[model samples]
Each structure stands twice: as structure tokens, then as C-alpha cells.
Target: MHPRLIAPGALAAASVLLAIPASAASVSPGAPGIGDPYYPAYGNGGYDVSHYDLRLKYQPATDALEGTATILARTTQDLSRFDLDFLLDVDEVRVNGARAAFAASGEHELEITPRTPLAQGTAVTVVVRYHGIPSSKQAYGFTSWHRTPDGGVGANEPEAAWWWFPGNDHPRDKATFDVSVQVPDGTQALSNGTLQSTVSRLGWTRYSWRSDKPQATYLATLAVGRFDLTTGTTESGIPVVNAYSKDLGAQAGAARASIERTGEIADWLSGYFGPYPFNALGGYVPNTTTGYALETQTRPYYSPRQFANGSNTSVVVHELAHQWYGDLVSVAGWKDIWINEGFARYAQWLWSEHEGEGTAQELADYAYASRPADDPFWTVRPGDPGPENQFHIAVYDRGALALQALRNEIGDDAFFTVLKGWPQRYAHGNATVADFRGYAEEVSGASLGTLFDTWLFQPSKPTASAARTVSLVPAEAAPARPRSWQRIAATNGVHEH
Candidate 1:
């Protein structure tokens, strides 16, 4: 399972071009919605997903998978039925270990209809078995395994988990994850949080990982190869494990330094935002050609090409920031993704401050000068990150700019106060931009309507107009860069509120 939040463009562009073996599973009980099918709106609050047991045999030679999955979930609402969305490749399913029906109405989702009424807080377990060549495409969620130029294997499944398993495949449905994968004898496997154990049976190795925190569907990850593994503990007792590829040479002290720094950052964030939400914190530096890193729960997956060298502190800070912003407090849906990227990006800026680097102003000024004035928060259209721009720039960079603006409007103490409070208030849950804005207004004791409107709602930067009329004292000289007598009008094509 490769769980990463995907941009809408990538999600919209997928099709069944690659060949997939057809399955003869029983006909589904009913049809599901054409749009993201897995995350159904359960009216009553508090969803409890108890456990997930996946039985799969993975063949790396041809990238084929034969597996059975049993999932148990509970809801606080008194409901007669429940439905789940999984990848379309599933061949058979049983609710509570009995033959149950399912339907594939969407590209990446299989609608699961249970046979019996599931009452409030009633535990449910689903068993599924099937076989197919899981798609390598990111569109339908489940991405099959692929090896890099080095022998190490890495996979990414953002917005789509259907390439591997079956479930409610959306970020909103927070659940505890339990995975068991059967791989070849020599290969090692790594995933989201911590490894429980590895049992050897015949030529297959079943690796188990369990996450105690509430995790979104897209944050699940899997890496497999002849990995060189090392284990250590942080100063605060969090486990630190490293998975290095054989072709990547020996692990160095710098890796440990970064991990220690990760612990420090986590402590700082915990005090500021909330406690470390998960049981473990670690990740592997996979050999890759891409520069972007995937923050997969406690163990974030970093690419060696980007993070191994000391030059990629921003990337490291960005992913580490996600542990609180994106992982602990998540976006309710795809449209509000800025809450994830924006907060994480600002966390990087705060780290820069802690490191005694350039002030937040210098960072914002540099970012503002680099991007064109026409576009602000990356969306020419809703769900479009930007016109040919990675969500990083629009979502992360400009999103950071928005927080800087808020910081300027509110004093430093109150600003930090809001930052530290949000993750705990919304942990294991979902939030919107409005939710944050309300929280900020409550903490800051000021109106942020004009600031949020100029920075967030509009795709244009605020123009800092010089104070036209300056009052100079006749006797005493004014301090250098004195405060402006009048507020400057920001006319960057946005009507000021």
C-alpha cells in the first residue's frame, strides 16, 4: 500500500490502458457512486475501524498479486448497512468470513455491501481473496511494485489505494492499519509506522506492520528489497530505524544526524502543535530519480537523490512538517489540500527560524519574487494545483506566504499560539480553511478577514504601497524604517475586503 495524497490532475488522468487480468468474483450487491466511491457519508459521528488483515502473495518477477483481505470497522451511528471502496481487482469478498457480494462501478473503487445490519459500535470484519497483476498506474489508486535502477524497490499510490487492497479509499476515513505481505525469501519490506514481526514460511516471508494512530488511506506505504536495516532509539525513546539499499553504499553518521534532528524537530512540533501522534518515527531513503519526498506516516519515505546530501534541508523539513500538519491533522477532502501543504510548508519556515537562518520575511520575499504576480494559490480552476505548476509551489510556497501574512497581522506570541493549538484540536480528524481561520481569530483577538482574503481566497499577491504622507518630528529624528502613518492599499487585482 503506497499512501500519498495525489493532485487532481494525476487522479483525473488515469485510464485502464495497461492490461489487467479479469476477475470472476461474485456480482456486487449494489452500485456505488461514480465519484470517489469508498468514503461514504456516515451521518453520526465517530468512526472506529478496528482491524485490517490482508493475505497476499506478491510475485516480483511479473508484478502479479494474489491476496485475501479481511477488514473490521465500527461506526457510532445505528446503521442498517455499510459500504466500502477498494480496488477493482478483488476477486472474492466475505463479510464476517461469509461469502458477500461486491460491485466495481468506478475505475478505482469496489463498492462493498454487507449482508447483515451493522449496529452502532458493532464490529465488522470483511474477508477478501483475489489475484491479478496490480496496475502500476497511479490513477486507480493501487500501484504495483517496480524496482529502481538500483536493486531497491519503491512504490507510490496517492489518492488511489485500489492498486493493492480494498477499503474506504479516502483521507477522511481515518483508521488503524494492519498489513501482512508475503514476499520472496530474500526481500525485506517496510511500511508506514512500525514493523511488528516477520515470519518465514517456505519461500515466502510475511512481514507485518501495525499503526496505532488514525491514518488516512493515502499515507500507507511499502518498500521491498534486500535492504540493509539498522535500529536505534531517540533521546525521547521513539524508535529510529533506517532502510538503506545495497547499491547506495554504507549508511553514514549524517543519516543519524538527520534522524536526531528529526527527533528534535518532532519534540519542538509536539510542544508547539501537539504530542507525537504515532508510536514510531522513521523512513527509508529510497533510490529514486525524482526529487519529491513522500511523508508516509511515522516512517516517511525520502528519496536518496534529494535528502541524502546536506543541500535538501527544506525537503526534509517539509516532509517532517507533515507528521503534524498533514498526518495528524488532515484535509477533509481534495479541495482543501492547502491546509495540509500550507501548514507543512510554514512549519519549514519556522524550522528555518529555529536554525537562525534568514528571517521569515526574507523567505517570503524570495518566494514572492520568484513566482509571477498573476497566480496566487496554484489554482486557475478548482482542484487544479496551478497552470503547469507543482502543488509544492502553489500549495506549499504560496501557502506559506499566507501564514506569513497572518503572522504579520497577529503578533508573534499569538501566531505561535494558534500554530501550536490546531493539531491537537483536530487530531485524528478533518478540517477546512475556515476552521483554521476561526481558530486563528479566536486566539489572535483580531479580525483576519482582509488578510486571509488577500492571501488565501485570491490568486494574487498583496502589493505593499508606500505610505504617501510621512510625519517627521521637527526636533527628534524618527527611527530608521519608521512605521507608516497610513495603511498601504494592496492593489494586486483583488478587491480589498
Candidate 2:
């Protein structure tokens, strides 16, 4: 089940003063799970995070990372204790600057019990000191954190932020971040947002980064390595700071050339999607450690292989577009992933159309006609695809196809309105599929239930008529279709003329 926002009345009812006599002094613990069906044990209830200040040091030789995380949050209900999704050996825990008892339990829950029961609407501060090898569990066929040859990359997507620091590790809870990491002198530590300052001392350096914009936990990143740093500004004046691995050697030149276009792409996307969402624009730690590139808030992480040739601008466009679709307006849960992947994929198609390669209509037609009726891609619904299929091709390809179908149903004006209005309305917050559908209907002034049902929910392939072109033809002039056997045989070995 999707987690619903807590009601004010319900929250008040949970408070100790309301539920029990004042003299009794009884308090209830916060719920461990936030009610997400896919990952029930992901986030905690009874509190909302406002900001996270993480200070850490890393040693590549021994693979050891020690950190102190200070989280400022507001209590939603009276609580004896609360939980944070943490997966490290904690040395000490403090609440509101006072010593608090804590224990690590069950997967990633760090159960912290304050010395005094916290009152509802009170502000609380939690500080945790922990140390160990930073590691991530495998989920959706990829590890969130990878150990690079020189250092390591933290790419906590889905529910892996706990591997590095404790927090309410879910997309629903977005918070600003101040992450500072100290590493070896020669190496550079990169993270989201603007580089506040860099200080060197005693063979070590500390790099401080500040992301004032509210960000989800999954989009938080920390990469440490020896990098060739490039700093500039986009045509629109957004700051651009990209870091390339020195290990690329000769390939570093081509990588830098491709990265230099970060400004150009941001300018183009801004024209279509309204103003850029964040204060910074750049890619970070481009290396081959991770097979795929991830939109890590202000600074995305790219794999060297993705941009090996100068011709791989589509992947760059895809990740940069995610800054608006995924990072700015995040999903409510894992089920709404298509809102992110679909928009990014559609941006690729739009870039292709803008470059005169092929129109989005042509791409949608090709994808619709290429897949067989029984293909699993069609069977798995993109809106609620399970955890295993969260990142499936259907999420990217079929999801884009659905958006194109909606665009064809509504004209370009209304479609463009949605593209710009979506992130603008829900910037720095979480949105669900229902929320999107209602917003689209409001903007387009059309009931899109049938179109959404056919494209997003139906298991079978939709008819070509679903994606009607802007210029319509007479019913009698419709194109004829091939027989089912012909399509099946073509999918198999035989092809019939």
C-alpha cells in the first residue's frame, strides 16, 4: 500500500498527553514501517526530517568510513522512541544534544530511545556516530555503492542510503543536506549541490557541499577519488561543476568534450521544462564502476562507458532531464517510477526529434509494432510494476509510449503545459499516479481515463489508432493490418510477404 500523508487529527491522537493521563507519563513508539507495500520497512513514522548534516572521513586503503550524522526533524506524534534506517555499527547516539540509548536491529532500523518522551510538535535533533566499511545491499540487480579502483561511489537508489548515513530513507521525505567528507590529500570528494569550501590539513582534505534544495534520500550521493575537475556555468547561468576520473587518461579528453555540453543541454531543457529546478548543473565521477548513470540530485553520476564515444549525448540528455522529472518532483513510492523513467526516456525522443533524427511519433509507432502481443513487457503494467520490474525496459520504453499516446490525444499545447506544470507544481515534493492523472486532466480539460487505461493498465498491445496523428484521415482511408499468424511467424523464424 502507498503511504498516505498523516492527518493532523490522527497525529494528535497518537500523542501521550492526549491518549494517556499526564501523571501516567506513558508514550508509544513510532511505527517502524511507513506503509509502503514494496518496501514496508523503508521509512519511519511519527517524525519528519527537515535537514541532514553529515560529516565523515574515508580511508581507501583499509576501506573504512567513519561519520557523524546530525539530523534535525519535527515530531508528528508523542513518542518514547523513533527509528532511522541505518546499517552501520554506531559508536554513540545523541538526541537533542543529550545521550540517548540506541540499538541496531532488523535489516536497517536504528532504534533510538530518548531519555525523555518527546512531545508532539517539538523539534528534535539526532546525532549518530558510526564507523565501518561502507557497503550496500544488492537491489533491483544493482548495488547502490560500488568500490572504484581508486576510491568509491555512493549511488543510493531505491532504499540503500542507510549504508552510508542514518535517515528516513524514502523518497516521500525530502530534506536539505550539508555533506562534508574528508579524504586523502590527493583525492577529491564530490557530492550534490554547490562546493561550499575545501580545506587541507595534515595530509588530508575536507570537501563541504551544501544542497539547500529539498532532496530525497535516494538522490544523495558521495564519490571520492582522484578526479580532473572542470567548473563552468551554463548558458542560462546555472553553475556547472563536473569531475572526470584521471584514470581515463587519453579518453579523458573525449569525456571532457562531451561533458562540456552540459550547459547546452541544460539551456535546451529549461526552454521546454520551464526554469531549471536546482542551483547547480553537472555530472560527477564519470567512471566504469557502475554500469549505468544515475541522476544524483544536482550532480548526476555517469559511467565512462556510457559516454565513451562523443555520440552518446542521448544518455546525457536522459540523466539531465531527470533533474526536473525525478529529482525535483519525486515519486511517492517505488510504484510511481514510470513518472521519472518515462519522462527521461521521452526527453531522449524529444532530443532526437529536435535534432531531426526521428519524431517521437515514429519512435512510439516502432516500439508499439515491434513487440509481440504476448511479450512480458506488455503484461507488466508500468504504473505498478513490482520491485523486480521497477527498472525494466517497460518502465522506460512503454512508459514513454504511454506519454506519447497521451500527447497525441491532447494537442501539443496542452501536452507542453503538463511538461512544464508538473515539476513546477510539485517541486521538491512527492507525487503519485493519481495526482498526475488529475493534474493532466485539469490542464488538458479532457477525461483521459480511457487513454490511461488502455496504455498504462491493459496487458495486450494497443491498436495503432490509440496514437492518432495530428492530421487525421477518413475512416475508410485507414491502413490495413497484418494477420496475427503473420506477426507471430515473423516473431518466430518465418516471415510472410
Candidate 3:
């Protein structure tokens, strides 16, 4: 997801408190959240989901969504009850083929008490029937369910599924998904992974898409509308599917121009982040008013505004690099967002080098000097920015700065090794910021504690001499350098995701 903001200096912060844990036996209720320090109520505990079989029907005309979600999971503890993060009005819930009592506990949680206690390590299947206008549902003051002209889209960062489907909504609970959305015959339903079937019957069409690899729930997406889908394969034979809403008007051309290069960009990114991690490669431009682009697993989501200026492969690179950093290896907690944003933004810098627009060193130096020492950009500690500042520009740019600093401190050989090997080591799993730093240190045999502290943890800008000493570039303030992150900041028209 795009950080979207140039955080102001007055963006107040006093402190930031920042996991998932299971319970023991005793037939107790599952914890309301999956133990994330930043969001205590984000995900549910006591069970790990393996897959989600979502059979949905969406009516764009009414902005109504009706669905039955079949969740297959394993109980982590003996449980008298469990919770699913959801918001829609549920008609009924069944656990293990028996009727289960359920109710809405909060804005986004559905508390379910099964007819029988679930035993630890036992496989369980939960079926939920629900109906609602997803766009009408809001939590935490916003809605990720976007009501488009012809259809609605379910896509956002940190939290998305609550408005569309129900499950353990946090990134820590990665699961494969089979999403079958039945829409009116004239419209198309698009989602993650390979298209299993496009079956039409009696004025209704069902689009079945499946993600073979485990994916974070937020990364699972939905788009139901009239679309111009471009399908093919990458240079390395990975399947690619690009979608542009027919209503995109002027931005359609630019969106296509950038999104069509998904295959080519994935090919380029594979060199640095190891082989392409997923079964498919592509993105979608859905004429959304959200004003941001999100790295939604195999197919990233792009706002029409992202291409409002022209074809921007830098944004494309930013999202595609996330195929490795964010989608493949998700953060252990929300506080570890740098593992996603910083790593992907750094990929944009690499693309600048590849395109001869600017070198990474030049961009890093430019980014460092673009902000004065007292700018809130420096105040946002990328390592553990509070929830409010999690998606600040500093998390993206300063996070990339931390990576470049690591590269310089550890030297090119070890840095590149760490870059290629980090995802492979934690592929399809959750990792933290400290985990990444440790991996870099393990590869470089260099104690980088102070360097990370200065760049990521410290709330003040490092001295200009550090830049000169590391990347051999004079850290002059605001030179007439090549187009750098200041340009990206201008182009990154994202909402408060």
C-alpha cells in the first residue's frame, strides 16, 4: 500500500506500543485479537486458518453483497468459542455441519459459540452466511469496500476483509483462498491467482479464482465490474493478468501502459528478490477514488489517479517489488511495515538506476537532503512508527534510506546476497524488522546495530557526513539532482491507508 502522506512536523506522537499467541486448554474463549501490539483487536486467536472458500454474490446496482464463507482452520487450543473479524449482518453460522449461535460483538467482529467445544489441533470448518451493503459498513472511521460505478471493490491495507468476508483478518494468519463471486452476466468478477472457471448461467456469471499460495487476507482482493482484462505470461512463463475498468476514461491508456509491464517488471524484480514467488503476475486499475495503489498479492490494485499524469513504472515497480517483500513474506506485526514499504520503495530506487534515470546512491542522498532535520519525516522512526505514522512517507523513504545505508555499510556483495536470500528464507511466512536486520547482519558479519538505530530508530536525521562516508556522495541540501523520491511523493496520491 502507498504511504500516501508527507507527514507534517506537528504530527504528534507520544509513544508507540507494539504479535500472535495461542491459548492452552480449559475450553476457554479465543482471544479477541491475535496479540498484535499495535492492533490488539485486529486478528483472532486460538485457531490458524488454512484456507477460505468464499462463495459470493454482489449486486452493484444495490451495492449489496451476499455470501457464504467456508473457513477451514486448525484449532490452536481447546476453545468454547472463537471470533471472526467481520462486519456484515450474518444470517446464520454453522460449525462442523451443526448450527452455531453467533452475534456481532463490535463493529468488525463476529463472536461465534459453537455447539461443541473444539479440541486442540482439530481441523474445523466454519460456514458463515451474511448479507449487507459493504460500502455502508465502516470501521475505525473508514471503509475499504469501494462502491464503483458498475461494481464494488474490496481492497485496503491492514483491514479489508471485515467489510467483504470474515476470518482472522490480520497478516499473521496467511491462508490460501478460493473466491467464487457470482455477478450479473454483463459484469466480471476478478480476484487473486489463476482463473479456475468463468461459468455463466441464467443471466448470472460466476468467476472462480484461486490463490494456490498462502496469502494474507488483506492481500486477497475482489473487483466486480466491466473490465478489459489482458492476459498472458511473463518472460519466465508466469501467468499474467492485467485489468483496467472500462470507465477509466483518460487514465485507461496510462494505467494499461504501466500495468501491462507486469510481466516485464516481475522478470526484472526476480533478479534481485530471487525467483518470482507466486503462481501469477499482474495488477488492476479500478477507477477507485481511494487515491492509492496497494500491493494486493499477485495482482496489485492501482487507483486511476496513479496514472493520471502518465505511465508511471516507478509506482508499478513499487507494487511489483512487494510481490516479494510484502506478499510473499508479510510482516510479523503492523509495526514491521518497513519490511514491506521500505523494501518496495527501495525497489523503485533500483528501477531508477536500471532505467538510467538516477542511481540508488543519488536518490538516497537526494531523499536524505530533501527533508530538513526537524521535518516530521525524520521524526517518524521507520523501525517502529506508531499506528498513526505507520504509513508515513518516512516509513517508505527513510525505510529505503535504511536499506541503502545497509548496502553501503555492508558492501555490495553481502547486501545483494541479503536482498536475494531474505525472501527465499522467509517465503510465504511472517517476519519482523529485527528479523530482517539480523539476517543482514548474519550475511555481512557486520554489527549494524548503530547504523539501523541512526537511520530507523532515532527520531532525528543523521549527520550529512554519514551519507558522504557511506555512499561517497556529498550530502548537500537540495541540489539539482535527478528526479528522486520527492517526485514519487508528488506522484504517490494515496489516501490514509
Candidate 4:
């Protein structure tokens, strides 16, 4: 069972303080977990993180990692102690430059108690020092940190960020980051944002990276390996950086050729989705691992096999589109994952239509008719498909169908208004499913209760509408599978890294 929030004893202390005229209420401990319906233990409450300063050193020979994380945060409520979602052993913890007592509870909770009770709205600095081998345990069908041939990759999603560094490891609590990693000579380290500086001494090099924009923990990525790093700028002057592993010898040329078109794609997307949300743009092509690609903040991660298969352009467009949909405006909870996947899927259709491959209407109509009436894919609601089925086909295909249906109901003008304005309004923030419905209504000046009910909430296949075409052909003519792009979309392209 997912963990629930453990309420503090502060109410009783407040009552005592109110009864006694001369006494003040004592601060109490914060809640151990944030109250999320899907994964309740994902984030901690009573504090807001502003920035994370992480310094890490990895030894590939032993698979050992030593890290010191200094987190800057502010309290939201009166607190004597608080918890961070951490899954490894901690050697020491300091709160506001003072030694603090800590204990490990449950699977991923680092409970820390400070020497003095903290007041509400007070700023605090926490430093944690730990040394351990990062876990490669699979959570949502992908390992959090995987040890590659030469080095390791840190690609965490949902509940796996705790396996590497300690923080309020959830998407709702976004923060800036300053990450630095030390590796052996002749190797490279890559992370989010811009490369700040690099210093080498005694056969060891430390590469520093900084992200000025607010980012969620799931979007945080760290890749350590021998890479051929390349840098350039987009037409609009956005910085572009690409890193390809030396192991991808022959396929590296095709990967670089496809990566060069990133600027043109971003320029096209900016015309429809407002401005690009990040300071940098590019991706990394590492040796094959998860058989998928991930939109890790500014720089996405891809497998060399994707390029070799001739799906490079479509995959690049899908991941780069996520910079606006998933990375910029995140979701409030795991249940609202369609807000991310759906938008990226629709972006793929939009790119296809622009390239003269197929229109979104045609794709949506095909998907609606391809499935049999009794298929479970259409029965599951994309809005809340539970934890285990979060990345199912319903979330991608059905979610995109919902958006396309909206585009048909509301004219192209209002629909495009929503596409552009929604991201700008909630830039670098989190939104829920209800928030999206309300925004669409507000922008279109029409009520869409029935549309959302049929597409998002109902538990069966939708009735045939004008958007769905009727077909009487052999099943082989129009296979029930998703289109080429949709096939890649099934990988839930955000988490695997």
C-alpha cells in the first residue's frame, strides 16, 4: 500500500497555548509524506525546496558513488523536524550548520530532527553526506540508475530519484539545480542546463552544470561515460549541445545528422506553442539500454538503436516537444499523466501533418476505429488509470483522441489559443486534470462537461461519432496497432532517460 500522511501533534500544542495566557505553542514535526492519491510517499510536506546543490563523485570500477547534497528550502508550517525522500544510507546530516539527529523509516524516508525547533516561514539549509552504490532497481519497468559498459546513468522518474540523491522527490515541488560530478580522466559527465566550468587535477575532472529554470526531480538526469560532445546554436540563438557515446561508432553519423534538425523543429514548434521553455536545447545518444528515449529537461536521452531503425526524426520531435508540455508545465499528481503524454502525442501528429505524412484527424479516426469494441485499451480511462497502468496505450492514444476531439468541437483558433496560452500561464508550475478542463472552457467560451465525461472519465469505448470513421475491411488492412509514431509513443517517452 502507498504511504499516507502522518499528521503531527501540533493541534494539541496549539490548544494548550491558547488556554494559557502567557505560554506559546511549541513547534511540531512536519508530516512524513505528501498526500498524493497515486503515490502518497512520493513527496514530503511542510517545506518547499528552492534549489539543490549536489556534488557527486563516481568510481566505475567499484560502482561506488559519494555525494554531498546541500538543499535550500523554506518552511510552510511550524516544524520541529521534517522528512526527505531518501533510499540510501546517510553518514551525516546538518540543519542550518548544526548537527542533527536522523533515522531511516519505511522504504524511503529520511527523518531528521534538528537541535532547535524551527519557526514557520523560516529559511533553512540542509546538508546530507552519503556513500553507497546507487541502486538499479526497476520501479516502472525501468531502472533508476543503470551501470553501463564504461560508466553509469542516473535517469529517475516517479519514485526513483531517492535512489540517487535525497530531496522532496516529486514533480509538484520544482526547484533549480547546481550539479557537479567528478569522474576519472578520459571520461565525460553530462547533466541538465548549461555547462558552467570544468577543473581537472590529479587525473580527476569535475564538470559543473547549472539550471536557472525551475525543474522537477523526475526530469533530473546525469550521464557518465566516454562521449564525443558537440555544441551549436539554434536559429533563434538557443544553445544546442549534443553528446554521443564513442561506442556507437557507425550509427553516430546518422544520429548527428538527425540532431542537426533540432533547431528547425524547435523553431516550428515555437510558432504554435509560444516560446521554447528552456535555455538550452539538444539530446544525448547513449549505448542502448531501455529501448526508449527520455526528455530529461533541456537535453533528452536516446538509444543508438533508435537511429539505426530510421525512426530518428519522429523520436526527436516527440522528445523535444516534451520540453514544452512535460518539462515546462508539469502535472500535479501521477494520475494526471495524460496531461504530459497526450500533449506530446498530439505534438507528434502535428509534426506529421506539417511534414505532409498524415493529418491529426485521420490519425485519430484510424485509432478510434482500429480497436475492437471489447478491447481493454479503450475501457481504461486515461485520466486515472491507477499506478500500474499509468503508461498504458489508453493514456497515449485515447488521450490524444480527446485533444483532437476538442480541436474539432472548438474551432482551430480557440484550440490553438489553449495550446499556446496554457503553457505560458502555468509556466514552470503544476496543473491538474480539472485545471485543464476549466482552462479549455474558459478559452473557448463553451462548456465541455460531456466531452470530458465521454473521453476521460467513462469506463468504456466511446460511441461512434463523426470523428470516428466506420470501416468494413479485413483486419489486416487496418491493423489494431498504433501508427509508427504511436508505436514509439507507447514507451511513455518521458521516464526511461
Best by TM-score, which number? 3
Model 3 is weakest, by summed lDDT over 10 consecutive residues, at 13-22
lDDT of predicted model 1: 0.61
TM-scores of the models, in the order given: 0.76, 0.88, 0.93, 0.89
lDDT (0-100) at residue 445 of candidate 4?
98
For model 4, residues 1-497, the per-residue Cα lDDT tens digits are: 99976456777777776875331265677787777788877789889999999999988777788899999999988787899988767999999999999998876789999888777788999999998887543343545786778787777456557767899988889999999999998989899999999999999999999999999987888888888988888888899989988988678888888776888888888888999988888888877566667778999877776676454677777788889888899988889888888888888788878876667776776777778879988778988888877877788878998998888888889999999999998999999888999999999999989888888878888876534422232434553333454544444443444
lDDT of 3: 0.89
Off by more than 4 A, model 4? 1-26, 136-142, 249-254, 466-497
| Alpha-carbon RMSD, each predicted model | 13.5, 9.2, 12.3, 7.1
How much does candidate 3 score in TM-score? 0.93
lDDT value, residue 304 of candidate 3: 93
Q: Candidate 1, residues 409-461: lDDT per residue as tens digits?
A: 78779988888888888988988778888999999989888777766666455
lDDT of 1 at 294: 69
Q: Write the per-residue lDDT of candidate 3 for residues 401-437, one digit (tens) a residue.
A: 9999999998999999999999998999999989998
List where candidate 2 sits over 4 angstroms from the true fold: 1-26, 136-143, 249-254, 308-310, 467-497
Order the numbered candidates by TM-score, best leading: 3, 4, 2, 1
Against the true structure, whose lDDT is highest?
A: 3
> Which order, best to worst by lDDT?
3, 4, 2, 1
The superposed Cα distance between candidate 2 and the true structure at residue 319, in angstroms, equals 1.0
- Positional deviation of 17 in candidate 2, in angstroms? 13
On lDDT, who's better, 2 or 4?
A: 4
In model 1, how large is the Cα lDDT of residue 89?
A: 66
